[model samples]
Target: MLLEIEKKIASFIEQVDSSFVQELFAKIQHGKMLRSKLMLAICPKHPDIITLCAIIEMIQIASLLHDDVIDEAHIRRGSPSINAVFGNKNAIMLGDIFYAQAFLKLTSFDRNIAQNVAECVVRLSRGEIHDVVMGNSFQESKERYFSMIEDKTASLIASSAKSAAILANLDSEKYYTYGLNLGIAFQIIDDLLDVFGDEKKLGKPAMSDYAEGKTTLPYLLLYQSLSQADKQKLKSYFRISSMEAKEWISEKMQEKEIFEKTQDMARFFANKALESIEGENNLKLEEIIKNMIYREF
Candidate 1:
């Protein structure tokens, strides 16, 4: 199913004039396709499932492309990012192109789906703005950080699953909850990986969250237990680019068991996602959610 979706994506982009766009698509790994899989698990028989999955995938890709430009990130998925290779201007334009294509395809479906997708994009943009405003600032509250991530990451996932339920005339609210929890857990694990994951496997630098001055959950938890001097030391390291600073932070986080605490938080959300789907015989999705939170890289 995912292969066919990838083929359709490739065919659609092949019509575009830029060779860079083609190269970018060619390099994409389409990791897991978890969103599509979740949707299919709920409404496998829906005639438009394939198209809906394609739209979801395109939206995800478009968001990542724009995010890389915003972060000025050089690497993604173990390779040079599109913006790193073709420049930020082209990357941003390509992201817009993908968004256009996704909405155009979605027009064939119910108007509600299109509206939800548009609303999701708006929320995502707002979240990105919040992240930018909070950058390198340790003053961010944990509540605000979770809200930002829910809008930035989970909204699309929730909408995608709910859209699938809508198509099937099922309980959209239940699937929405499932997707929401799953997305939050997914993002939390991603934050953990940014701190402790293998750079080679992640295809990006580890401790990138710290380097970028983004106060993720691990740092936030660790900060509360630190002495005033240690807290200041940690804050000072945010400005320093040295590997030693990253290592020092990593060692401190380990000493304080911050990583384990972060994983516990992720597990809590993962369990919530599973509970949302209780009694639904979707064992495949259940297993996927478990593996996603527990994944090493």
Candidate 2:
């Protein structure tokens, strides 16, 4: 089923008929297709599921390409980013092309589905801008952090699940709630990976988030648990280019058991997602939450 969706994605790009685009696309590292799984899990029997999944995948890729440029990141999924290899111009253009193609495909879906996905794109882009602004300062307000993640990450995931439910003729609101919580948990786990995950497995440098001036949940939560002097010390180390500073942060995080706190927070969101689908008895969705939140172990 995923293969069919991949083939559909290929056809969408192949329509561009540009060898350069094909070359760039070839280098993209596809993840687990989480959005595709969400849709298929909800509406496996829908005739248009393959096409819809392909559209969502394109949108996801486009967002990532733009994000890499914005973050000035050189690696993605352990491979050199397009902006790093082909230059930002080519990368941004390719991303634009994918976004354009995705929306074009989106028009054929039900109006509600189209609107659901389209509105997410607006919030996603806005969220990216918010991240850039927030990155300029040390983010301490949990309220602001949660709001940013909701727009930047969870919006698309939530919208995808709701749209899937719409197709399945199920209760869209319940699935949206499930997806929203699921997306929040997913992003928190992603942040955790940057701090504790092995660099070899992560495909990027561990602890790169702080270097970029983005204080993720781990740092924020840890700060809340620290002594006044330690909190100040952590802030002083922000964006410090020395390996020693990175090590100190790591040592402190371990000493404070900050990662455990982060994991519990992630599980909190995952449990909420599970609650939304309790009566539906969707084991696949249950497994997704468990695998995602607990994958670090």
Candidate 3:
């Protein structure tokens, strides 16, 4: 299923946007190279080989390009980001290339499938905007944080699984619901890594969100749960010049309880993902969701 899907996507992309066709093709190929390794690492026998491969490739490219713009990132996957290499203008163009490619591939299916993916795309874009707004304002509300993370990260994953179900023509709502829960869990884990992750492993700066004044899950949870004195101290740090945000983040890291609390929250989301799929008997999907609980950055 994955392989066929990849071929179809490649065919569609090559046909729709011939100007950047080769570059887009190369991008999807690299995406497939990574995904093939991941699929082998996790579930070698995952059904629908052609279709799954194509969707994963499409998703990976779409995400990497968009994320580069979002992070204004200098590097990605251990290489210079498209923006850094080609300048922001071309980088944005490439991101558009990916988006157009996704839409082109999506249109090959029914209206319902296109609608689902279009909606997810809108959500993803809105999520990105929300994060940018919150980061600029240093908003730390938990509800806002959840909404931002859900749209920015999880929506794509949810769309992937739901689209798979759409391709399979499955009538069960279990796929969409499970995919959504899995996306939420996935974002929670990513948020955890934003604090605890290694710069080398993450291919980005550690605690970069703090440096950017973004209030991620850990920051929000700490801000909400900490005592007034600590909150004031933290807020003071945040309000200060650049050097102090780093100092405050370092100080916050010393509080072990806060880290554990964040972990528990991630676990809670992962559990909810499992609950969403309880008794579905789709062993492959179940394994995928369960493995998300322990996925390393």
Candidate 4:
């Protein structure tokens, strides 16, 4: 997949250098290559592999660059965020560079692929805007929080899988539908990590979402299930009036019901994602999808 993508990108973007554009493109290529390997594990004969890989790289980089700005994130991929090192102005511009690079690579392919990629990009931006606005109040509804993750986190993965099927000229509609479901499952497990997994395993702060006032699924379910006293205690943490609030909330999250409910929801989505791939020779990809449900990070 990467060999095909590098060959095509080289053919298209002839002038390469050690600038930020090159660095951004390189990161995109890395992510695209990983996703492509996951795809190839299922369908080795997939054609248009180069286009799929290129598009994935572009989309992933766009999100990362923008996400750093949105989250005011200091670290990404265990390194200082682009915004932190380069500042918001340049980081945003670099994100734009990546966005344009993705589209430039897309034009080398057919119109359908380009359009599909564009749609996913739009959805991701929309999701991010919604998340920014939700802020501290976002945790009010579990469904609303899940919807946000669907847009912000899972849309790119959905696009990656869908674009691959589309580029291969296979069942594009069903392939994307499967990808969408898989993306939701993948993200639910990611939310679980925010509460239950180690920061070292995830390469970031474990409870950053909570600290950021993002109401993830696990937090939402646990919040809803909390006793009135516990709810009051959790609210105090979100208020940030006292530094001791985190310990109080941590004690409440140890409830078995809270953990089990979130796990059940993750499993439900994992099953739905598997069901979406009926009749496709995608077992290896399916295994990758399922492992995400129980993955440590």
lDDT of each: 0.85, 0.92, 0.66, 0.69
For model 2, the stretches where C-alpha displacement exceeds 4 angstroms are none
Predicted model with the maximum TM-score: 2
Arrange candidates by TM-score, highest first: which order?
2, 1, 4, 3
Each model's Cα RMSD? 1.7, 1.0, 3.9, 2.9
lDDT of each residue in 1-297, candidate 4, tens digit only: 568766666444435343655565444324324456655554467566765675566567667788879888888766777777778887787777667767866787777877877888888888998888887463677777778778876677677777777656677766666667777776777777877777787678666777787777777777788788877667656625244665665566775466667778878877776777777767787777667776654
Backbone clashes under 3 angstroms, per model: 1, 0, 15, 0
Candidate number of the best lDDT: 2
True-structure lDDT of candidate 4: 0.69
Q: Candidate 2, residues 1-297: lDDT per residue as tens digits?
A: 998988899999999999989999998888889999998999899899899999988999999999999999999988899999999999999999999999999999999999999999999999999999998878889888989999999998999899999999999999999999999999999999999998899887888999898889999998898899988988888877578988889898999898899999999999999999989988889988988986853
- In Å, residue 162's CA in model 3 sits off its true spot by 1.8
Decoy 4 TM-score against native = 0.87
Q: Write candidate 3's Cα lDDT for 1-297 as tens digits.
A: 445556666675676656655664464324324333323323344454354445456655776777677768787666777777667677676667667766765566667767877888788888888877876756767888888878877776666666666656664256566666677777776777877777798877667766666777777777876788988776666534466676666677656366777778877876776676677556766566567666664
What are the clashing pairs of model 2?
Answer: none
Least accurate 10 contiguous residues by lDDT in model 3 = 34-43
lDDT tens readout by residue for model 1, 1-297: 889878878776776767877876776667778888888888888778888888889989998999999888988777788888888998898889888888888888898878877888898889888888878577437898899889999888899888988998888888899988999999999999988888888787788877776888888888877889999988887745688888888889989999889999999999998899888778877987978976875
